[model samples]
Target chain A: MDTIIQCENITHYYGQKMIYEHLNFEVARGKILGLLGKNGTGKTTIINILTGYLKPRAGICRIFGEAMERLSPAAKSRIGLLLEGHVQHAYFNIEQIEKFYSRFFPQWKREAYYELLKKLQVTPVQKISTMSCGQRSQVALGLLFAQDPDLLILDDFSMGLDPGYRRLFVEYLKEYITAENKTVFLTSHIIQDMELLIDDCIILDFGRILLHEPTSYILERFRRFRFDSDAPAFPANDILRNTERIGTHWETYSFASAAEVERELVKNGATVSRLSEDKLSLEDAFIGLTGKY
Target chain B: MYTSLFYKEWIKARKLLLLLLVVFAAAVAYTLLTTIKQFHANPVAFWEFIVENNSIRTGYMRYLPLGAGILLAIVQLTPEMHNRRLKLTLHLPLDESKILCSMSGFGLALLSGLFILSGTALLLGLRIYFCPEIVYSDFIASLPWWMGGFTAYLLTVWICLEPVWKQRIFNAIPALCCISLFYTKALPGAYVPLLPWLTVLMTAGFFFPFYSAIRFKHGVQ
Candidate 1:
C-alpha cells in the first residue's frame, strides 16, 4: 500500500503549553484513519498542520507525498478539507455556494453534490447561515464530495450532530468510500460512531500518540483488566502501557494474554475478583489509554 | 478560477457598493440642486462664492469617499475574519496570496469604480450651472475623498486580518495616521504637492492586509 499522508517528529506548542512533541503517524492510500483523543489533546492541531493552515515548530507533514507546509495548489486540489464546525461561506445560498466552488475544481461534480443536499429538504436558494448545523454539514459534505478529491480530511465530523444525523453521515460516507480509491483522515470525539467506520485508528493523549494501529488489531488484542480492592495498587509496566485507576476501581491496558495480565496484577498486589474478559470497544480502549486525567 | 473568485467577492461587496453609490449620488444631487438655485439667483455671486468659500462643500464631500472606504472594508472582511471564513478561503486550490489579493482587489476595484462614477456624475451635474473652470475646481477638490475610500479599505483590511487584538490596535495607529494625511482641508489645486505622496502611500498600503494574511497563514496568533 502506498503512503498518502505522513507526519514526522511533529513538535508544536501553543505558547508555553505543548500540544504535541515528536509525534509521528501516517495514512495509507484508500485507508480510513481516525484520530481519536479527548479535548485539548491536539487532534485539531494535527489536522491544521496537515492542511498547511499551521506551521509546526519542528518536523514535516506530507500529503500526496509532498511537504504539506509548502504543498502547491495542485497538491492542495487533491485534498478536500472540511473545517471544524462545518464552516462555509454562510453568505452564499446553497446554489450560489455550489456555483462559486464549481469554478475552482476541475472535477467538480454538481449532480453528486445536489443529490446529497436534496435529501436535507433544503431549497437551493437558502443561505447556509439560515440552515441548521446538520444542514450546513450536509452542504459542506456535498461540496467535498463534488470536488472529487483524492483525500478527504474531516475535522470533527460529529461535533454537533444528533445521533441520527451522525449515523446518516457515517452510512453515507461508509457507502461512498467503499467503492472509491480514496483516503480518509477524520477526527471525532464520538468514538462509538467511529467504531464502525474507521479501519485504522490512533489515540492521542497528553501530546503523545498512545497507540496507532489497525482498529481491528487493537480490538482483538488489547484488553482492559479491571481490579477492585479497598486500596488497589496501580499496575504499571511494559505490559500495561496505559492505565486508568479511580478510587477503589483500577484498570490496566495490555495486549498480553489473560494469564500474563493475571500474573502481573497478582504481583502488583491487586486482588483480582472474577477476572472477567470483555471485548473492548474503541471508546473503552481510548479511555483506557488516554485516561480521565 | 479568477473570474469566479471575483464574482464571489462581487456578490459580497455589490450591495454595499450600490448603497454607497446611492448615498454619494444623493449628496451630489443636493450640491447640484443648490448650485442651480445659486446660479439662477445670481451667477456672478455663485462663481464668487465657490472660488472664495468652497472649502466647506469639499470637506463634506471628501468624507464621503473616506466613509465609503471604511464601510466597504468592514462589510466585506469583518464578518469573514470573525467567523474565520478566511480559513475556508485560504484552503482553495490557488496561491494563498493570490486569493487574498483577489478578495481585497475585488473590493478595491468595485469601490474605485463607484467613486469614479460618482466623480463623473458630479462633473456632469455641475456643468449645467458652472463653467468648465468651476466644475474642474469642485471635481479636483474631491479627489482625495474618493481616494480616501481606498485608504479606508486598506486600513480596515490591516486591522481586520490582524489575528491578535493587541496587535490590531498597533496596526490601527499607522492606518489612522495614513488616513489623516488625506483629510487636510485644501482648495481644488492645493493638493498638488500631497497627491503624489498619498498615491504612493495608497499603493504601498496595498500590502498592509497581506502582512496580516501571512501572519494569519502562519498561525502567528
Candidate 2:
C-alpha cells in the first residue's frame, strides 16, 4: 500500500498532561481511515497536528513523504481539511465563499461546486450565518469536494448533521473515494454511522492507540465469550487481558484466534454456543478494549 | 491569489467600509462649508481664522487619516478574530505574506477612495466659493504618509486582537498612556517628528503581523 501520511513517534502534551505519546501510524492512499475516539480523547489535536495547525513536541509527521512542517504551498494545496466547528466565515454568502476558496486551491472546480450545491439543495446567495447547521455542513462539504484534494481530512464531519444529510455525505465521500482514488482521514464519535463506509479503523483512548486494523481483520480475530459460573478459567497469555464474572455467568474478552479460543473453551468443559458472528464495530471495539462503560 | 484574497477581505469588510465612506463624505462637506462661511462673513477674519487655527487644521487633517486608519483596522479584523476565522485563513494554501499583503492592499484601496472623495469635495468648495490658492501637489504627496499611518494602525489592531495576546492589560495600558500624554502635555517635543517616523514605523509594522502569522502557522504557541 502507498502511504500518504506517516506519523512517527509523535508526542504531544498539554502542559503536564500527555495527549499522545510515541504515536506511530501511516495512512495508506486510496483508502478511508476512520479515527474512532470518544470526546476529549485528543482526536482534534491529532488532526490539528496533521494539518500543520499544531506542532508536536517531538518526532515527525510527514504527508506525501514531505515533513508537515516543511511542506510547500504546492503540497499543502493538494490536501483539503474540514475542521469540526463552523468553517465558513459568517459574513460570507455561499457564492462569495465559493469564489474565495476557489482562489486558493489551484485544482478547485467551480462547476463541481455548483453541481454539489444543487445536489445538496443549497442556494448560493444565502448567508452562512443565516443557514442551519446542516446547511453550513453541506456548504463546507461542497467546498472540500470541489477542491478535489488528493488527501481529505475531516475532523468529526458527521457532527450536527441530520441523518439524511449524514447518509448523503457518506455517499458523496464513497463516490469521491472510488472515482478519484483519494485517501481520507475522518474522525468521528458516531461509529455506527461510519461502519458502512470505513475500510479501516483506529481506536484511541486516553492518549494511546488501543487497536488499529482493517475491519475484516478485527472481526476475524477478537471474540467475546460468555460462560456459566463454573467454567474453568482461560489460560493466561499476552492476548488474554482479563476475565470478569458477572452474577452466575462470566464474560471473557480475548485477542486470540477465534477458533483457538473456542476450542479452549470446549476443552475446559464449558457449554460453547457459537454466539452471533456479528462483527464488532469500531465503537464496540473501543469500549471492549478500554474497559469503559 | 492576491486578487482573490483582496476580494475576500473587501467582501468581509464592505459594510463597514461603506459606512465609513458616508461619514467621511459628510465630514468633508461640513469642513468645506464651515471654511467657506468664514471666508464670506469677513475676509480679514477668514485669513485670521486660517492663521490662528492652522495648528488645529493641521491636527484635524492629520487626525482624519489616522482616525480612519484606526477605525478601519479595528472594524476589519475584530470580527474575524472573534469568530476564529483567522485560523481558517492561515490554513489556506497561500503564503502568509500574501494574506497580509491582500489585507493591507484593500486598506490602501479604501484609503485612496476616501481621499479622492474628500479631496474632490474640498476642491469643489474652493472653486464655488472660497477660491483659496492651495498647493494641490503637497496635499497629493501627503497621501502615502496617510496610507502608511492607517496601514500601521490596522496591522496593530490585527495583532493585538489575536487570541494569544488579547490581554486587556496590554490594550488598556497603551491607550491610557497615549491619553495621559495628550492630556498632561507630557508628549515629547520629538513627538511631532515621530509622526512621519510613525508613518514609516507603521508601514513596516504592517509586515510584522504576517511574520507572526507565519510563526503561528508553524504552531509556535
Candidate 3:
C-alpha cells in the first residue's frame, strides 16, 4: 500500500500547554484508519495540522509526499475534509452549499453530491440553519464525498448523529471505500460503530499514542482473564501489567497471547475458563489501554 | 476560478447592495426635493442655497460611497471570519494573491455601483434645475477626489478587522496624514499630497478585499 499521509516528530503547542509532542504516524492508501481518543485529546488538533489549518510548532508533516506547507493546487484539489463542527455557511441552502464547494474543488461531482443527498434523505433546497444537526452532518458528508478526494479526513463525523444516522453514515463510508478504493482517516468517539469499518486504529491519550496496530493484532494479543473469589492468586509474569480484585472475583488484562496466558494461569493451580475472544470490543481495548471509561 | 469566487461573493452581497441602493436613492430624492423647494422660495438667494446646503450635499454625496463601501467590506469579511470557512477557502487550488485580487475586484465593483447612483443624481439634478452657470465641470472633477477618499476610508475600516498588523496603522495613518498635510501645507502644493493620499487610500481600499482573501486562504489570524 502507498503512504498517503506521513507525520514525523510533529510537535504542536497551544500557548503554554502542549497538545502533541514528537507525534509520528503514517496512513496508507485505500485504508480506513480510526483515530481514537477521549474528548480534548488533540485528535481535532492533529486533523487541523494535517489539513494545514494550523501549523505545528515543531517537526514536519507531509501529505502525498509533499510538505503540507508546500501543498500545490493540484495536491490540495485531491484532498477532502469534513471539519469537526457544523461548518457550512448558515445562509446557504444545501444546493447553494454544494455549488459553492464545487467551485473550489476541481473534481467535485454534482451528480454524486445530489445522489448522496438523496441517499441520506436530505433535501438539497433546505437551508442549513433550518436543518437539524444530523441533516447538517449529512450535507457536510455529502459535500466531502462529492469532492472525490483520494484521502478523506473526517473529524468526528459521527458527532451529533443519532444511532440510525450513524449507522447510515457508516454504511456510506463502507460503500464508498469498497466501491471507489478511497482512503479515509476518521476520528470518532463511537468506537463500536467504527470497529468493523476500520482496518487499523491509533489510540491516543494525553497527546501521545498509546498504541498503533491492526485491529486483528490487538484482538489476537490482548486477553481479558477473570477468576472467582476462591481461585488462587495467579503467578506473576511479564505479560501482566497489573491485577485488580473485584467483589468476588479478579479481573486482569495481559498483553500476552490468549493461549500463552491461559496455559500460565492453569499451571498456577487455578481453573481458568477462557472467555470468548469475540467478546473483546474496541471500547474494551480502548479502556484497557488508556485506563479511561 | 477567481471570477467564480468573485461571482459567489457578489451573490452573497447582492441583497445588501440592493437595500443600500434603495437607501441612497431615497436620500438623494429627499435632498433634491428640499433643495428645489428652497430655490423656489428665493431665486436671488440661490447661491446662499448652494452654500448653506453645500455641507448637506457634500455629506449626502460622501455618504453614498462611504456607506456602500463600508457595508460591502463588512458583509464580505464578517461571515467568512466567523464561520471559519476562511480556512477551507484558503486551501483551494488558487493562489492567495488571485483569490484576494478577485475579492477586491468585487468590492470595487460594488463601489462603482454607488458611483453610478451618485452620478445619476448629479446629472438629473443638474438637468432639471438648469444650473449651467453652476460650474458643473469643477464638481465633476472633484467627485473622483472624494470617491478616492471615501474608498480609502472604507478600505482602512475593513483592514482593521483582519488579524494581521494589530497596530492598525492602516486605519489611522491615512486620516492623520490627510489632516496634517492639508492643515500644515507640508508639501509643495496644498492639494498635491492630498491627491496621492487619496490615491493611496483608494489603492488600499482595493487591496482590503485581497487582505481578507489571503487571511482567509492562509488561515492567518
Scored by DockQ, the top model is 1
lDDT (C-alpha) at residue B56 in model 3:
21
lDDT of each: 0.83, 0.69, 0.70
Enumerate residue pairs that collide in model 3.
B90-B217, B163-B221
Clashing residue pairs in candidate 1 (N, C-alpha, C atoms within 3 angstroms):
none
In model 3, the Cα lDDT at residue B25 comes to 79
Model 3 alpha-carbon drift over 4 Å, by segment: A103-107, A119-124, A227-250, A258-278, B49-56, B127-193, B205-221
Encode model 1's per-residue lDDT on B14-111: one tens digit a residue.
Answer: 78877887898898788677666767888787668676865325344667888888888888887678667888888888998899888889888878
lDDT of 2 at A28: 92
Residues A1-293, candidate 2: write the lDDT tens digits: 78999999989998898888998889999878988877777898888788876788998989998888767778778888887864677788889888888888877898877777786555678888888877787788788888889999888888888898788787887887778888989887777767777888888877788778887777666666555645556654455444566686666666776566666666667676633333455556666666654
What's each prediction's TM-score?
Answer: 0.95, 0.84, 0.83
Candidate order by TM-score, decreasing, is 1, 2, 3
How far in Å is the alpha carbon of B91 misplaced in model 1? 1.3
Per-residue alpha-carbon lDDT of candidate 2 for residues B1-221, written as tens digits (9 for 90 to 100): 77777777788678877877777677767766666666777878766754543311322344566667667777667656764567677667877566667776787778778877776765665556432443243243334445544554555554644456644346445544442332222212324544564456555655655655655565554
Q: Model 1: residues >4 Å from true position, as ranges?
A: A228-232, A241-250, A268-273, B42-44, B53-58
Model 3 chain A: weakest 10-residue lDDT segment is A271-280
Over 4 Å off in model 2, which ranges?
Answer: A230-238, A241-248, A257-279, B41-46, B53-67, B123-152, B165-192, B218-221
Question: Highest TM-score: which candidate?
Answer: 1
